[model samples]
Target: MEITSKLLNSANAIIEAKIDAKSIENKLNDIAKITAKKVKIDGFRPGNVPVKIVLDRYKDDLLKDAKQELFKKAIDDGLKDIDKKTDEILGEPIFSKFDEKDGNIDAQIEISFRPAVDVSGYEEVIPEYSTPRVTKKEIEEKINELLKMIAPLEKIEKDVLESGDFAKFDFEGFVDGEAFEGGKAENYILEIGSKQFIPGFEDGMIGLKVGEEKDIKVKFPADYQAPNLADKDAVFKVKLHEIQAKNIAEKLDEETLKKLVPNEEDITIEKFEERIKTQIKEDKFQKLLNEDLKPKFVDAIVEKINFDLPNVIVEQEIDLQFRNAWDSFSKEDMEKFRADKDALTNKREEYRSDAQKSVKLTFIIDELAKVRKIEVSDNEILQTVYFEAYRYGIDPKKHLEDYKNQGILPAVKMALIEEKLFNDIFKKDKKEEKGE
Candidate 1:
């Protein structure tokens, strides 16, 4: 057996190995010997099976297991020869070349690795962004939005329906004087100006009187999802049964206060508004970081520090981004992308900058995490899981196992870590700016 290491680049290395086929065969024979003791054959005893028979029946399986063992051993030997450890390897060893000759086999495998990064003044170079301003108007709008969410319905005595009013009505559609399927509903509650109905249907209901029956004509969009309704003109006979309106309170009631905050007491308007303001700041801070600051920060850090990136990691990033966006494409569009190599390459190239940014950021954050001794806690993970489950209307207790199985738990943990690190950096930068 012979093995040699070659540095293809700073971030990539290749390990070439030449192994005699006789050695592999010997290993296969040993594996066969072990299998013979556990074998079951019609003509053989419980603990006895012919080696030749075992080899004949399981040569491929034995060779596969032998190859795995040999591959691991080869990696260990290569690392020892290079004075490196497994931790230096970024991703798995990619099989670059494999061929078998008469009595020996030659193979080359590639490894992507972390390159040294000089981030001495990353704090000074990375961009800082201002938190989004929370205006009084926005606060009022948000409060109104929340009020709408929990507003009570009240019957109105008004005879005429107007914009922003709710109407309960029965509607049936007809095309060419013939009723169409899925075009009728009884006692449907609809808000005017909501546009929940087809174009001109809800607008046509404006100024309609309760107990009045009328026909609304509408033309379905040419690009409508339903083939049968596309580009078709239809009429709906609407009979308004009731006029309803939403009523919101002037002040937060006791029950409403508890509903607003399930786990809080002594909740006042001032306290609630302050809480909402804090929440708004947190939400805007995250959005601001993700959309504006994060990219600029990454670019600045990258510009300040130069390092080689592994092609394999970049390629993986391109593939991952493409797959993440795969669902947005039509089958025809996806096929075109696959069929046209130039187009696909161009598309991949567009993401090259972003991929490099992400890969480099991962390395920088990893080292910082180690140096700072930053760690994610189990309690934090559980809190994130329960919060996410609650936000998505999943019962945390019931879907705890599901989250674990779906790999959501680890992802949440990583996300929390990233959020925590960036937020700390933001605060530190702000303090330095203030000469603190």
Candidate 2:
């Protein structure tokens, strides 16, 4: 075996190896001897099967195994030549060239590693912002919302249905002079301004008196989820039967307090108010972090830092971005790409700059997390996945299995690490700001 390697960059390299016919033959015989010692062939004693017979019986399988072994050996020798370890490689080693000519094999493998990123002075780019402050008015508003959540519905003596009032009604819809599926219901309770129905449907229900029958005309959106009903004009015959409203409490009582915080015992109105204020403050802070501070810091660091990203990782990112964008392309645009190959290439190229930036930031976050000694435990990741699954009404085990089968668990872990990394950075800044 002859092996040589060249470093493409700090994180990438190419290994070229050639295995001659003699080496191939020797490897096959060695594998045959091992198989013979383990096999119990017909008319052959245990651990005494002839090597020649074993090789001839399992010729194809033995040759395949021999080739795999030789390829691994070549890669191992090449890594040594390049002064790299097998554990340092990122993704699977890509075979750029593999050919068998004149009873000799020539192979070339491309390997990449996580690039070293310099996040020194990254703290300087952290955006300065005041901590979120919860006002008395905001806390009161949130309390009012909680009160509404547990409010009882009562029949109202209103003559007309107005916005924010609930209506009990019967409705049947027709499109193009014909009734449609999923368009008819009896005694449906709907809030007048909920916008639960299609566009203009809720607004059309307003200003109707009890026992009134009217036709509400609505057109489905052009991009509606139901293709058959999309962009179609429909008329719903609605008969208002009753009007109702929530009888919200003007004051928070002990019973209502228990309902608001169901698990807590010995809780008082003042403590509940404090809880609401804390929640509002936390929500405001998260919004500021995610929407403003995080984006600004990420953009500044991505623009300020300079490093050569692994080509393989950038290309993988570009492919992912391109595939995701392809799902949203119009039929006409997709057809053009299918007709012209260059159009597809150009479309993919559009995402390359973004992909490079994304991959670069990923590495930066990884290195920064290491520098900060930030780590996400497997249990923490599982808890997050389970929480998300329950939130979306999916089975947690199945969701986790799907992520693993799709090879996205690492991506999930990376996302969590990035979140933790940035949060740590900002929290330290906050501590410093407060002289903590």
Q: Identify the runs in model 1 with alpha carbons over 4 angstroms from their true place.
A: 8-11, 114-118, 128-151, 171-186, 196-201, 215-237, 248-265, 310-312, 325-351, 369-374, 382-409, 428-436
| Candidate 1 lDDT by residue in tens digits, 1-436 | 7888877777887788888888888878888899999999889997789999999998899999887777777887887777777888876688879998985779998887888866676779667455456777777777777877788888989979998999999999998899988999999999999888778999989989999999999999898888988999999999999999988866565777677777877788778887787678678878878788877886787677778887677778777787787788798878988899998777768777788877777778766666656789999888877887899899988778887788668667767777777776664434443542
What global local distance difference test value does model 2 have?
0.89
lDDT of each: 0.81, 0.89
TM-score per candidate, in order? 0.79, 0.85
Instruction: Note the residue pairs that clash in candidate 1.
Output: none
Total clashing pairs in model 2: 0
- For model 2, how does the per-residue alpha-carbon lDDT over 304-338 read when each residue is reduced to its tens digit? 88987787777788999999998899999999999
Look at candidate 2 and give me any clashing residue pairs.
Answer: none
For each of the candidates, give the backbone clash count.
0, 0
Model 1: lDDT equals: 0.81
